[model samples]
Target: MNYSATAPYVWDPNFADAPDCLLSADQCVIQAQHYFVKGLIEIPVIGSDEVFSWGVWVSLSRENFSRAADLWDTPGRESEKPYFGWLTTELTIYSPTTINLKTNLHTRPVGERPLIELEPTDHPLAVEQRVGITMDRVREIAESLLHGARSESG
Candidate 1:
């Protein structure tokens, strides 16, 4: 399940100049991105008006923090332990521009590329996925009603 809960702190630009801590543990909700005394990961779901990208950073645990540097220094092991590293994606929208990010957007599986299940190219979302305009696809469909440009190519 998507464990999406904001921490006790509120990072409203109107209220605080920076990310501010609000509630204590128990009362605190695990936020999407914010450092805490308690170990909490900040996953960045990045995307654009015409593109989408997703990433998650595991909040460093005390046990994991110390060894994090060593593990992090090692190459060819994005799926290793001690520190769960960052994963970046190049969003391409094309002849099939829109691409499907995996169910766990941030966590791409070990040693495999995320797959996109293509449906009939009809809805803006389907078209976007089919074409490859991802980040924008999520915003356009999930939150707002934006008409997207048609494309048979990326």
Candidate 2:
């Protein structure tokens, strides 16, 4: 209704991390509020202000991945094509160290009376901003999970 009053602040986040329009509208809204109050100041606010997003090392959200696949199902128009692949917003401010994050998803099939149930396990996924993440992080998590299952097997 009032463009002047609303024009004081605008939201501009580096969506270099987000590949698609998914469950991050709130993040952008908060960033807009942060700018409204701070007036173009580059400061990392505590308690999840406009800090780096958390999409750097996580598996691409199913929605984004599907969108990318559909959009890029052709070639020769790659550059002009919009990029909607992977979770790009998530980043690790501190990386190249032994620290990492990982997760596991397991499912068990049940009988006719019961459907399938899913179980999730997580671990540290090692990553480097320069080169990105490697399979070691996944393997580490999987191995740890396997070891746990083995220990509990017998």
Candidate 3:
């Protein structure tokens, strides 16, 4: 399953016309203050080689965001160190919220989204990231997302 958020959770439509604000397929800057980048958070699917991914936005520090932008078109940019960020998408399937979780954005080769690694913790999302989830769980998630089941079983 792949889910994506078009903008950061803090984004507001009012800023869409602001000179200092910008939003693109993979990058964003709100009021030239909040910086964000799109990345993939992959969760392995058990009993198979498949993986579940979320095309999520993560807020990064200005310095890290600048560094990432500097290398955006540079080859071998994947060698850069991962940037610390906070999860800015709310995957409502999980309780206690999926926003503000600690994360490390690992830069990938050009043409690929960065990999988002959640901080190891007992949170359902983090737990699923550390340990693979069953196919049944994947189906449950799919149903919840597709059918608006509103189940928070994660």
Against the true structure, what is each candidate's TM-score? 0.25, 0.20, 0.94
Residue-wise lDDT of candidate 1 within 24-44, one digit each (tens)?
Answer: 331221342432222222222
- In terms of lDDT, which candidate is stronger, 2 or 3? 3
What is the Å distance of residue 63 in model 2 from its true position?
A: 6.7
As a whole number from 0 to 100, the lDDT of residue 107 in candidate 1 is: 19
Order of models, best TM-score first = 3, 1, 2
| Number of the candidate with higher lDDT, 1 or 2 | 1
Q: What TM-score would you give candidate 2 relative to the actual structure?
A: 0.20
What does candidate 2's lDDT look like per residue over 44-151, in tens digits? 223333321121222223543344334433443233322222122222222332122232111112211111111122212222222233344434435654676688
RMSD of 1: 13.6
- Number of clashes found in candidate 1: 21
Best by TM-score: 3
Across 55-120, the per-residue lDDT of candidate 3 in tens digits comes to 999999999999999999889999999999999999988998999999999999999999999999
The pairs that clash in candidate 3 are none
Select the stronger candidate by TM-score from 2 and 3.
Answer: 3
